[model samples]
Target: MESTGGLRERKKLRTRQAISEAAIALFLEHGYDQVSVADIAAAAEVSKRTLFAYFPTKDDLVLHRIADHEIEAARVVRGRGDGEAPLDALHRHLRARLAERDPITGLCDHPQVVAFYRLVTGTPALQSAAARYVASGEEALAAALRETTPGDGRFAEVTAALAAGQILLVQRALAAANQACIARGMSADEREPDALAEADHAFGLLSGGLAPYRR
Candidate 1:
């Protein structure tokens, strides 16, 4: 038997999932802007206050699916193996995620994943919200890099920020390209070979350009 706390957590998860699914369905059918919090609440069979309790903002309804990845870069750097360079660790992780068809890699061709990508990219408000998430991720990655980087004071901070920006820019470009291919109806397996090659090339450039900060 599950503990009371465990059951409560499961119930909360179910409720959140229902709310998210309802929001996505409505957004896809009616346009994100056309949908209101009260509309989603009604579709999910929850009160507006209850929906707000789960997701503070309308953007959260869509972006919550990706919230787990917000600190992924920082986690990768902090948890790198002994003697592993941060960039190398990140490069390896990207390859692994690509191989797994992780949606964050933008290589997933799942109908829902493709639709979610379209929904976010096509919405100006969601694009702005997504940018905030990217900025936060970059900041976390920079902090991790600063911890592992050599030097002191402003030099380390600036270098880390520069390196993080470059790394994330590469990631974003690669993901955008992959998403484009998928949007054009290419399957993830069909795109994997090129995606892996491109990742290698991108990381190779970073390794050369960021050698000074590669700790």
Candidate 2:
């Protein structure tokens, strides 16, 4: 039964991936607004009902990664090492991501990926969806901080919220810088050296006493 369940889960995942890829290709070829669920389903060789089962809305097809980021900051803060500060953990995580050429940095300048980014950044609907995801990230960070600094209550909550806001802002700045670099025809490897420098510059402002941990 467990093996069967595992196979079922893998099949579902493959189906989801196919649907998402199909949706993105269509959205890029035609404008996102011009593309419909039925269109994506047809492209993916699936039925509309099946597509809906995987992604209830068209926005979900595009903004899926944004939705996943909500818990990430909180997890970083909560899982910091005994001697590590929350900000330091986040910094290390980001630096490592830079080294890894993480996709969030707008490193992939492939036409489809660029179109996807432009689609999200340019579209009001997708922008709103991304904003909501970021807001959820703030809440998750605050909750994680509450758990970490248990006795302080309100102070911890406020500090965590502030940190989360700054972190997200830094993220936006990094992404913007990367996007600009890519738009200028810089390769991912070519962009990283400068992008990391800019990222460090942005992050430095938030470290130390800049936004002190209130709790």
Q: Candidate 2 — worst ten consecutive residues by lDDT sum?
A: 206-215
Best prediction by TM-score: 1
Residue-level lDDT for 78 in candidate 1: 96
lDDT of 1 by residue, 62-138 (tens): 99998899989999999999999999999999999999999999999999999999999999999999988899999
Task: Point out where model 1 deviates above 4 Å.
Answer: none
User: Stretches of candidate 2 above 4 Å error?
Assistant: 208-211
Candidate 2 local lDDT, 2-112, one digit each (tens): 698899999999999999998888877787889988889999999999999999888999999567666887888778888677767777778787777666766666776
- Candidate 1: give the clashing pairs: none
How many clashes show up in model 1? Answer: 0
